[model samples]
Target: MAKNKSKKKYISGSLLFLLAFCFYMVFGPGRHRHQPKRQDTEIKNNEAKSSKDNTPLRELTTFTGKVTAIKDGDTFEVLFDGQPEKVRLADIDCPEKSQAFGKNAKQYASDLCFGKEVTVISTGKRDRYKRVVGTIITADSINVNREMIKAGYAWHYKQYSKSKELSQIEDEAREAHAGLWADAHAQAPWEWRKEKRTKKQQVSNQ
Candidate 1:
């Protein structure tokens, strides 16, 4: 009778141990491990959102407007928010109206953007002429500044911009002898302006 009692006590203790182990596995350290993984995923998602929000272009206030005038290959007037605003295409300089291919460049710009809705991305900075210095994206998702360089209608304006993509496209255009690149001695707009200024200074001094 004592041996039977001993066996009964041993079985009861074993059953209690199994039950405690199962309870711990369901609601203890094992369950808590999954919590850290979920927290890590949340952190990563927030970080990605923060990075996207901090993008340079995203930080600039975007303006939607319609192109009312193509002043040149690299400049235009826009009807924005019911007001007319002149915009100088950033990172490019087109020929003067008197320069070779100047008319062709203006015609190309007019064809691409005149009467089309465009989005202006600016840093809220204006040029000496009070024109907004910005990048333009047409309704068809065309980048007007880059397209001008690629078509050889404008120079990359490296003195004002350090865009490698613009430089690359300009090089390709030159290699293909597209538009202004067909002329072996195409003068940059800045150089042309400087020459004109020098001539004016000389005439004034005389």
Candidate 2:
């Protein structure tokens, strides 16, 4: 009877050991069933928060400020948060300094942005001169760059960038023979720059 009792105790102990091992296998350090769901919830919440934070109603591409000084027909330096920022009007190339319409272009640009607070919308890059090229808009919602083109003081560079409305306005201005449009014989500013450089080189060679 004593031996039989000892055997029964041994068998019961073995059964308990087996049960504990099975339990450990299902809920041990290697188990990942519950962890994945928690991680998934955290990721979703973070994504939602990021989306909300970045959602824009109307994005101003660049900072808004007052136009302090007009440099040329298509370029000016704006007085922003504190410092002066040079900005070139995108998609509009005006007469060169040596051209007939040069003074008119500078005067027009000065009239448009000088002393007025305007929004500078960027095209995401800068020119070689480190000026942030963009379209300037006034508080009254006028696109000064497009206005210059429409008034024929400028020609469409069509290279830096262009919007549909601006392109159309420039086309109409060209067709209507406005401002510099009065003379179709004028060369583009880019071509003029090249010619000026070539002449300078010839003079230097001489």
Candidate 3:
């Protein structure tokens, strides 16, 4: 009877050890092998949420501001969010101050936008002068940049822009001999700048 009791006790102890091992395998550190996949899924979800939250600002393509100063025909300063920002009209180049019809272009820009609330449609770009380049829309929804080109106050600036609509308007203005186009020798602003630079170079060489 003693030997049988001892044998039974040994079998009971072995069974308990087997049960413990099985329990550990199912619910202990060994079970954590699958946890890394869950953690990875959570991390990806967080990143996706962050990206969604930032989408609006990243896709920001337009803003509204008041035109505080008309620097020239194709450049101006705007009061946006209580700060002055310089803006350059995209896709067009206006006459320089020294060129013919330059003052008229400035005046026209001022008459159209100065001190008025305007909308700027950013082309996701900037100029070499660090000016924000975009299309300026006046209070009456007139596209100031395209209007300037249509009025012959500015050139289409094909070197920088390939807008077919702007090109068509420029053609119409030229055909009608409107504004600066009325002059038989109206020169493009880029050409005028190049000529000025060449003249300066020649003088410096002398």
Better of 2 and 3 by lDDT: 3
TM-score of each: 0.70, 0.67, 0.70
> How big is the positional error of residue 30 in model 2, measured in Å on the Cα after superposition?
78
Query: What are the per-residue Cα lDDT tens digits for candidate 3 across 1-206?
Result: 99999999999999999999999999998689889989999999999999977653222258788999988899999888877778899999999977999999999999899999999999667667767889999989999999998888999999989999999999999999989999989999999999999999999999
- Candidate 3 wrong stretches, greater than 4 Å: 1-61
Q: Rank the candidates by lDDT, best first.
A: 1, 3, 2
lDDT of each model, Cα atoms only? Answer: 0.90, 0.85, 0.90
Task: Determine the C-alpha RMSD for candidate 3 after optimal superposition of all C-alphas.
Answer: 13.6
Q: In candidate 1, where is summed lDDT lowest over 10 consecutive residues?
A: 53-62
Q: Write the per-residue lDDT of candidate 2 for residues 165-204, one digit (tens) a residue.
A: 7788888988999998888797789989998999999999
TM-score of 3: 0.70
Instruction: Write the candidate numbers in order of decreasing TM-score.
Output: 1, 3, 2
Error of 1 at 166 (Å): 0.5
What's the TM for model 1? 0.70
- Clashing residue pairs for model 1: none
